[model samples]
Target: MIPKYNLVLCTLLALALAACQTPWVRDAQPRAGDAAPAVAEHPTATPEPETKTTPPTPAAPEARIEPAPPPDLWTRLRAGFTLPTRLDDRRVQLHLQWFKRHPHYLSRVVERAEPYLPWILDRIEQAGVPTEIALLPIVESGFNPFAYSHGRAAGLWQFIPATGRRFGLEQNWWYDGRRDWVAATDAALAYLQANHARFDGDWLLSLAAYNAGEGNVLKAQRRNRARNRATDFWSLDLPRETEKYVPKLLALREVFTHPADYGLELPPLDPDQRLELVETGGQLDLALAAELAGLPLETLYRLNPGFNRWATPPDGPHRLVLPHGASARFSQALAELPEAQRVQWQRHRVAAGDTLIGLASQYHTTVALLQEVNQLRDHRIRQGDHLLIPTARESLERYSLSAGQRKLALQNRKRAGNRQVHVVRAGDSFWDLARRYKVGVRELAGWNSMAPTDTLRVGQKLVVWTQTPAAANPNIALQRVRYRVRQGDSLARISQRFKVSIRDLEQWNDLDRRRYLQPGQVLTLYVDVTRQAGNG
Candidate 1:
């Protein structure tokens, strides 16, 4: 109803007032679900700009980690060395000085011990003994498994026959467990631990006992206790060998602990580089084992010196040590091979005079074994019966490291003096033989590769090294000759033909009087040419 210009100006003023109230009403309004506020809202008010909400970022996953490998064998050994390394004692100093003077001695010993030290260290750790005990082999045998002492101690642990037997080490024609490093190590460690317990945790006394026997150590302790003296290892009146033995071990600990101080460069032995013990399943030929392991025969022999023949024992030990890489191959090959094919067999036809005893002797087997193989109820066998005999795959001579071969090599070795072969008689003794040969008993035994304590058989042959030749001696003019046995030949006939006694014939040829000689068997005879001339 107002004029046009006046109406437009009034309408603009109203619109501006409405716009100013709109924001106030919208801000004053209650949020959704909140209690209502006392405020009036403009119906056409613009809504607030829609707010954008961002999602949280996911957390990163943790990184994976790996554990480090174990340290080298020497480092592990050093870490576990719990023995007293102080060298204040004069005895320990003396040994230390000697070791320092011979630096190469440790070098050679370490070289020999490389293949065995890791295992030795592991055993010592498991037994909860001082790691220094790992070095005992160096003191005992310079790590030589084949070492045999004049005192009848043998192998790396230097166990005498009696001690070895007591420790369950079997000694037989086929095997000597004393020379087995693995078995000997376990036995030696067990022995040391037993002595340790016996000596009231005195490691020094325990080590002394290991060298000089527990009885000797106990006897020394008893004497000391009676005297009201200290029963310590240093205070005891031990044997000269044992007195130095404990100190020697301590000195070794010092050298090994601080090799740089002694100017010794220890050999690097990887902790992972090790030998693995594998089950052989049963008796196996050494040659076949070597072939299966992809190793040389000599190498196999070196690793397993316990075997004395071309094959393992007929009885069971049923285990072998092989290189870590070769163990799997050997085990797989052995498993694939048939049991019957393990050993070579021969079919023997029983003749009229063929007794099990005679056949066993001829085939170098036992009567019990012959009976078992032939499935005989007893030793009785009928003529024309076939028997399966186990024989060596290779010639006996091929096994050069065998006991017999070693003896033959020793007998044939050239020496400084004239070699004389002596044929033993029924009443012969080492003392009597040494006196007759004008040689020291030790010298006579050494020439024949025998110990003085070894028993002598009536037909056993001994080698004597004399300064004078037998031919030059007027009392006995002897000549060495080889005689081949013919069919139907007897020791009596050979003795009669050679103008030698029957006892002399058996002794020269290493024969049994009860057994008949095989045809074409060679016999070594030392003929008395002077007696022959007299008979002529």
Candidate 2:
């Protein structure tokens, strides 16, 4: 304020102070040890925006859980058992002791039952009977489909021929429905249900009736009522076999219920491994069926023991039970096969001495069947006439479980005596054979694996277990020869050429007499070589 230069200095100080207050000048000014700030070419450029972050939420606990798979068949069977397991009767205890002593008997039976048990259980459940009924087969036939009892009962249910027929089971040359598990099971369950109703829902009485006929059981009850005795199953006077039968079933139930307690290890069966019945649509040869199913012939026979021959019955029931896996293959293959190809056929020319009876015996067929096939009014047939015959495609021996094969096997089984083969003549009977062989009729029939009631066919072969060797007739020197049939062959021609009777050929080869001989078909002949040499 005192001098002009002083005034200029004051003005500069004021300007500098004012410049320090300006943000652009202050920010532009640099500090020690710091780099200079970058000058913005475009001062009005927009700044970048900040982003906010979010934390993740946790997952909820699992809400649904799957149920555990059902237990094995044995466990399920035990759980479903509804029989009276608390029987204190001595008969039941006796059987229980027997079972405990012979554990392997049950083991073997269970092994055989594996293929059948699941289906049986399903049927039993559906039938609404006590699950214990499934064990009845164990007592009856040991669950054997091929079981033929001394009492003429057959199959797992052990139905006699009469009972089988009453239950609509057919017994024929081609099939025995008594041996069919499916048919027999249905028949047996139906019979049991009927008995159950008849006996006023008494399962024990019904079971006893099954062993001894319902008529017998009713008669026993009637007698008990007359005597003023308790008419319970235990109180009634039943057959000895029937008395043991009901208790045997109950003991099996107890053991099966607590197998571990009895120290029994039931055979392990996969519940899922099961059999299914598939319809074959028509008469199908068992050999071809087995081939189509990719199964062994023996396996097919075991599963379907109903069939008695190489082919199923021509009339009906054209069904086969196969493993679940093989059903599709078999059904498809069967659908494509022609009906003409279902059975093998052969043509035969009638020769001299070719009577219908002789031809039927030779080809293992019936006179009626021959007449039907040949369109003959009478048993008469002219020489040099051609006839068509149905024949097995495979060799007879290949049908290991066929009726003839089974009989052959039984006959060939070694016993404790000198084995003699007797060719049955027209007049032969069980009584006649028993007298000739110096053996009981029952024993002779049994030796041949036949019931005394079974008919003896002419030219049938019977095995005699004799204490002494059979005397050889000088006129009948015999030799076994396997001869293959040639074209234009006939039973009469073969018989004459070989110097053997047609009956002998039939017996030796198990030939069906009504069928024609095929070219290249092998025939077993018991040729009289001595007679042949004499004739030559």
Candidate 3:
């Protein structure tokens, strides 16, 4: 287990991939355990009777182990193997060549998957599916539940929004069931099963259908049938990606089934690195959950990757995963905590000009979370809308970063070593600073060792990192000049003329999306007279 520490606020201390769960204040964090005097059940032992004639001594009671393996994930996975080992196909061999060259990627993915592999493989076994299906995540998302594709598929299984909803995976602002391993795995298996049956029990065809929807597969199959061609997966014309998807899985299966053949070494699984599921009585903040579990909040977030917010969802599945070591203590402490105190909240009333993004910044939370907690269907909220915002909690050590993310962070630091300085003005805020620099609010906060919700005084200087220096950046020469509305005036035209984003124009002038512009009406415009090449 990773050692826990009472951490301090610093640039390096951050929950990677987590935007809102950043540390607030964590000085002298409380420990999970407290001792009390034990009460005596019995004062003394009774004398034994000498009635039995030479009664044999009873054997020591054998330690009872709950019916499970020794918590070895690798052994468990291998034992549940149900997939065929035959692999002489041309496509599979080609994929093996690529994988052999990039063995490090495989090792890193396997390591990241350690926290959930045992549970996932167990479920696949109970479903009577081949253990090879367990490696499907490697092909889809590298076992990262937060993985999102440019194609709009998300989660480990990479379910698209429509497909996820069809499988009963909720996609509300609060939670994305697509990222829930328990839900997504089940849904993926069900879809695969349906596809298998539809394709007459052909596993290869089923995998192809999983990549490209079953409808698409059916359409291709129909074309093959019309032409009286062979109806097998390889014979039919399919999407290019689907054609390789099955081969990728087969290649992974070959390596896992015979690692030594490819000269790759698989590490022994840690028995203590086991996941434990706990029933949260209700929605609970993960900061408190980590404290009670005697572990880092990042570990909790990793175990419960499906939880998008700092806390569990308000509706159902009031459960979260913890390290097996800390599960008992966390569950016990949670039971004793008051329901109202599970998450510290502040009531807010929306003003006439209040925006969700602005309000979220003021509250040190995300706009999506605000929408989720209030169950708002859209961004539109009327004035005086009562909002309950979760207050930030102090944190200790940051969640461990994935190897890839760590490398990227290092690369960014090296690139951002030379930065531009931005001074806070009369109308400056965290949101404005990020927008003006084209960086996220969290990135700005981390750069300065401050939280997004921290207050900034006028004349406070912030170090802003850019690809180019401030003197060379054309945007730095932006001048706030007034432009009069003409007969053919439009926000898009004005934005193009000034080389500014339409969103920035709307924000700067506070104009509604469909508001009309009258001729001769004056508008504020920030333009750059000095144009520079290769500037963002």
Question: lDDT of each prediction vs. the true structure?
Answer: 0.79, 0.81, 0.72
Which candidate leads in lDDT?
2
The alpha-carbon root-mean-square deviation between model 2 and the true structure, to one decimal in Å, is 15.9
- By TM-score rank, best first, the candidates go 1, 2, 3
Per-residue accuracy of model 1 over 284-347 as CA lDDT, tens digit each = 8888888899988877777887888778888857788888988999989998999997888899
**Candidate 2, position 265, lDDT:** 90
Clashes of each: 0, 8, 0
Ranked by lDDT from best down, the candidates are 2, 1, 3
Cα miss at 65, model 2 (Å)? 3.0
Model 2 TM-score (2 dp): 0.75
Which of the two candidates, 1 or 3, achieves a greater lDDT against the reference? 1
* Candidate 3: regions farther than 4 A off: 1-86, 347-357, 364-388, 395-536
Q: How close is candidate 1 to the true structure, as a TM-score?
A: 0.77
Against the hidden reference, what TM-scores do the models get? Answer: 0.77, 0.75, 0.63
Candidate 1 runs further than 4 Å off: 1-66, 348-368, 375-387, 472-536
Top-TM-score structure, candidate number: 1
